[model samples]
Target: MDQPFRHIIALAALALPAFATNARAEEAALIDGGKLLLTNGVTTIEGASGGGLASWATIAGRGTDRGIGLSTHVTLIELPDYGWQSHGVALGLANRLELSYARQNFDTRDVGTALGLGKGYRLNQDVFGAKLRIAGDVVYGEPLLPQISVGVEYKRNRDAPVALTVGANAAKGADFTLSATKLFLSHSVLVNATARLTKANQAGLLGFGSNGNDNHSLQFEGSIAYQLSRRAVIGAEYRSKPDNLAIAKEDDWLDLFAAYALTRNLTLTAAYVDLGSIATFDKQRGGLLSAQLAF
Candidate 1:
């Protein structure tokens, strides 16, 4: 098995028993949860607490009233001519603050050979993020106010030479996001809107900006989810990308995803993603699979 997959399996094996023991010992004592099961959210691309493609205004744990929660996820995407794999860990404190770290590997695949870099070329990136939920409540259905949060992602690309060759101005950049998320329990629906300021191209895989325009631009990302059952959620997400480099124009990303909670601490998510064009490769649509372990 691949090293990353092995690591995930090992970690899950070790943690699952602890979680099961704790739950068994405390089953009768219910922790007054502020949000619904699987509602705290799946991990975002940048490792924040949110949907698959974009970050939401929620923290990363089921412990809503108080306590700490930790979540880790492994995501894999197989595009038409490329591939992407990401894994990350996030920790949420008191359902008010969140911190995360993620590693991304973009596989050039055959495209690498076409670009004269041989086959199987990969670009690596690391992302560190922090978020603070400032106001409102997602489950506060009585007043129907949206949850609001602010976040920042500091991204660094390891393929600096390749990024520069592709017209990227820098290998490092930061993105700031302000998100508003609202959930209607009566209607079993949730909606989120986010505005982001970023200079990173292709979510930092292609690096930050270009020579001509080295400043950040405002972008939008959103998600809408419907709760089908106590443990199932179906959602769709859209994320607009920055067009910074001239070598290969970036495009918007979209995904239709479903998440099912096997238990309070385990959730699985799958999605059909249409990433539009990436690096001049059209129709970079693919499937995504993600497993999240949370406590």
Candidate 2:
């Protein structure tokens, strides 16, 4: 071959390897199939779904990529005589970890006076959280092992003292959680279990505490999810909390959820949540909807 032709051939050969490397890197950055929304627990996303111990082996943190993503959720609850609502947004950075912020609004309806807070009393709280994947494979040839994650959250109450007494002094507090997850490739199912320690003063707003009381408690959360198709999944979760208040007895909640992926960058989730109750209020039930976007 002529010298010019030989030189061109050499340059083309070198470019091929670089292109292949870039392709592999891009594949690695994509989220794995077993975990939806880059979360280890059930569809709840937060600690409510527990971690890796139940049925879904999904990990909680983002993947190992250096990208950012966003998630938002809205929740509604129906009490015996009142209704409550909450909205939240979270940001994920890289695939190694995530940071999130959430706000909850509660409408007392007619139960406000019965709870000593009065009618139309609304309470709001803010939550800040971080999640880190400590171990496990993001892309694995074998399907039995799932990822592991560790995380924490700090909650601040924005409710006025006279309006809501449960979180009067709950200005700043923390929750620590650990999770383990595993995926069954043959069955297309994921299981996750998690344990947490918290002094959050409320379920951070799910309402499990009162003012003048601060006690550390342990909670267990678990979830199981099965992929119904390439873009859809169904799951459930259960959480156990503590009753650290002199005014109320904390109860547990169960959740059933469904999620659908619209595209590589977007997904939507919906759930039916039975919160049971927080004290003498024996009937509390709710629904939640969420959307997630990744880039």
Candidate 3:
């Protein structure tokens, strides 16, 4: 071969590795490696990211497939004449099994007096819950499809005598919920639906036999969300509760929320909830704010 031709070939070969390395770096830079905020119906679960309180179904599994992590939430709910607050944390082990513990404080603003329970009677309860994901993926599969999960919660009511008089059936009980979620890649939407079977007396802490009712009923919950961007999402959800007590009529609520991803390990969510009404009680509407962290 000619001397000049040999030199040209060697030079081209020397530049090949550099060109390949640059190409690989560019491809890696295009991939969004941060956690993705995913939602289904009223439930919001961590995607590639971790956890935040949005209510609804979320993508299952914790990390990539090597280990597990923990998700914690502090939630507050405000009603027209009453206000309730809950504080709890959950452990997501291997993204397969989840265990959670929560404490709820129910305060009677003025409704307590009408029920003859006094000025302010606070009812606190401890709730323990577990969830398992049986199918699907949120990271690698279709952007519009989601995973499925089955879970149950055991609640222990601590409202003693007051609960006996008003919510005579306010005892410990187990509630089961079946959840299904789907992510719409084309529209950037997430949808979720859930059905729960629960008892009337044990679920209603005020009293079951108020007007002569004592039984259980089925409840339905759903939510839909749209991804505004990689870091923001907007969604809404509805929950139907049973009215086992005659003194009050149970009603469902609608929620609108917007969430922001702060970092790979943290997220912030804000929501507005509207609880129609219970009997003559005024409609309850309030705001909810939550922060979540995962590792």
Ranking by TM-score: 1, 3, 2
A best-first ranking of the candidates according to their lDDT comes to 1, 3, 2
Off by over 4 Å in 1: 1-35
lDDT score, residue 292, model 2? 54
Q: Considering TM-score, which of the candidate structures 1 and 2 is the better prediction for this target?
A: 1
lDDT of 1 by residue, 222-257 (tens): 999999999999999999988988878788999999
For candidate 2, write residues 1-295 as lDDT tens digits. 4332343344334434543554466655444332344342322333222321122223233333433344455555555655656555554434445455566676777777877778877767766666655567433534655566666666666654532455434455667777777666568776777777875533566433446555667788887778787678888888777666555556777878887777654667777777676545765766666655534
| Residue 279 lDDT, candidate 3, scale 0-100 | 37
Candidates 1 and 3 compared: the better one by lDDT is 1
* Model 3: per-residue Cα lDDT over 1-295, one tens digit each: 5332343344335434543554455543321223344331111321112222222334222233233445555556666687767666665444444556677777776877876667676767776666655567544476645666666556667776765655446456555666767766667776777776666342434433333544556788787778888678888877777766554566676788877767655667778887666434767777767666544
Instruction: For each of the candidates, give the backbone clash count.
Output: 0, 21, 19
Worst 10 residues of 2 by lDDT: 48-57
Error of 1 at 125 (Å): 0.5
Model 2 local distance difference test score = 0.55
TM-score of each candidate structure, all chains considered together: 0.88, 0.73, 0.74
Q: Relative to the true structure, how large is the alpha-carbon lDDT of every model? A: 0.84, 0.55, 0.56
* Global fold similarity of model 3 (TM-score): 0.74
Worst 10 contiguous positions by lDDT, candidate 3? 40-49
